[model samples]
Target: MLQDYTIKKQPTKTSKLIASIEFILVLLAIQGVLLLFNQEVPTSEVAQFRILANSNTAEDQRIKQEVQKKIAPLLDQAISQSTTQQQLHDRLQHLEPTIEQLAGEYANGSAVTFEHKAALIPPKRIGFAIQQQDVYDAYILKIGKGKGDNWWCALFPKVCYPEEATVTETEEEPVKFFVWEWIKSWFS
Candidate 1:
């Protein structure tokens, strides 16, 4: 007498459940890694512009406003033409004498200084995005004492102006599968 035998392997219910759980954990880990990398993208590449008033007095405030008005158009023109941070810096440098002249006209002959440097800026809302407190390359126009309230805005992105500026909301990138949606699909 002779006999033939064959073997077949099938996954049990428990094994299938374990495999699904493992797959979900792996997906979640990958999502976390992607989020981490996304967060690491640099935000310090932008340039800023600031105007510091001489004092908080009514007259000084008026002078600051005047100076801002006179320089706003110049800044807008220069910023609009610039395509890079370095170009912005160079344009500001070239315009320093003109800026000082404009400030002196409104500042009653008070000395004004134009400086480009890295400075710690406070948190502020620029257009749509809220800029966090951090060090940034800034073009500062210091008037006389430079001890009063300051006006600031982004220069490289060209979002700053004396008037109210609006930023169109950008659409977010769509994710392939959200965690909640993935979980629901797995159970169903």
Candidate 2:
């Protein structure tokens, strides 16, 4: 029974200091992750583009599609010269007459009106960026009565892939976790 007795090793001050440092490091890592997760995507930097239909009639819808096809490229080209939202708005404002003319080319006798306004829009998902149902500065082309369903896209970020564009999804990358490896390093 006397031979079976064993003494336990007591923790040293250096070991206590190392444990305290490790605890602080883990807390910092947790805080970094929390900050990343809690951050909201800023909406002020986004610019919205829209085309409102004259009415839901087949002919009206067809004209709307034609105007969409024609004017989108021009808008892209115009904004390509811009670097800021204000510049984008200015470029569009300066080009409004031209835009209205081009929109009318495909509108086919339908009235077309263009404007830059603070407009209320529905929540929209365009790529990974989302727009909540809120008012935003927008470039709007109202076709005819403008009483039907609308077409919208993210004009500034260019996140909305066109329906005609083809997209190939990449395979998911494997996640390499480092927290376990980091903890294991303390023993080695």
Candidate 3:
């Protein structure tokens, strides 16, 4: 029988380089998978409510209903009052105080400020009532429209686009404005 011989193999530079590249690729793939897992998963439903601390659960529902009923009439009244061009400012001013009072009352010692967008601008707030009761606090419709004319689908964390307040020469032109194109440019 011939003497048994064994040879130990040393890793070659080419093999080492190949292994390193493969390891790096594997790490990258793993990182990609982890990133995918961590990405924000959107909820199918837009409305997600968190329980407010010290909120009266019973009163909240009742209040939400009341708010919805009031909105339509309030808006109509505002438009009617503003029918006269000169009285338009007065119409806006009249509504501001009422909203402020309502917001303050609703806040219940917690601070809240009412913000109004230009009339030509899309509605920022849209409220719906719970079938159970006629209360203003049941559901507050917070809406935010994007740069497009598309009616803002109500969403949380209201969207605000910076607009310049300008006095217009003609009534037909928007009094204050930020075109969607200009707003987009600012971001770019």
Candidate 4:
């Protein structure tokens, strides 16, 4: 004969409370692991490289690309030997004059200034890791007035470069409040 497997009694209040507490504990444990990963993956030791154009004009943007192409190789050579953030920054500082000269030449008369300093980077989700907005060591190259669109990447982590080290960015998903939603689901 076929068996009737349906529940004959609803769970008691105490049992329901126990189940909910267990679920919450599991969620907390998972969140703790995620927090640890976020803290370690995207580090403060990142070094950024940014090229800013004089204006938003096509000519200015073209000059920006030309500079980028020419300067990227020299940077690749300079930072390749460094194993730590301090070493990378020192190398960049040493290479500053050459970098400016190359960019100035590629800029076609546009005024160029190269600075290696601490700069603010907006929050970015590059590949699977989310990099929070913070100040980082950077090499900022300004063309002419330096008021236009800019091209930048975390040179240390290599977010925008493929052959360099590979990382990501292109519209990240928004953060979700899963705990609130989970609680509502239980009530419903």
Q: Report the C-alpha lDDT of model 3 over 103-125, residue by residue, as the tens digit.
A: 44544454433343222222223
Q: On residues 1-188, what C-alpha lDDT tens digit does candidate 2 reach at each position?
A: 35777889998767966986888798999988766655355678777788888877888888888888888888898778889888888888888898899888877787889977887766776554455767787878998778765444434212233332334444658876686566566666
* C-alpha lDDT of candidate 4 relative to the true structure: 0.77
Q: Following a full C-alpha superposition, what root-mean-square deviation does model 4 have from the true structure?
A: 10.2
Each prediction's RMSD to truth: 15.0, 14.2, 18.7, 10.2
Pairs clashing within candidate 4: 126-168, 127-168
Clashes of 4: 2
Query: Each model's C-alpha lDDT?
Result: 0.77, 0.75, 0.41, 0.77
lDDT of 4 by residue, 1-188 (tens): 99979878877766767888998899899988877766444556678888888887898888888989998988898778899888887888888888889888877788899887787766666655688767787789999988774344433444333454533445759877977777666666
Query: Over all chains combined, what TM-score does candidate 4 have?
Result: 0.57
Worst 10 residues of 3 by lDDT: 129-138
Specify the highest-TM-score model's number: 4
RMSD of 2: 14.2
Q: Where in model 1 is the C-alpha error above 4 Å?
A: 1-42, 150-188
Per-prediction TM-score:
0.57, 0.56, 0.28, 0.57
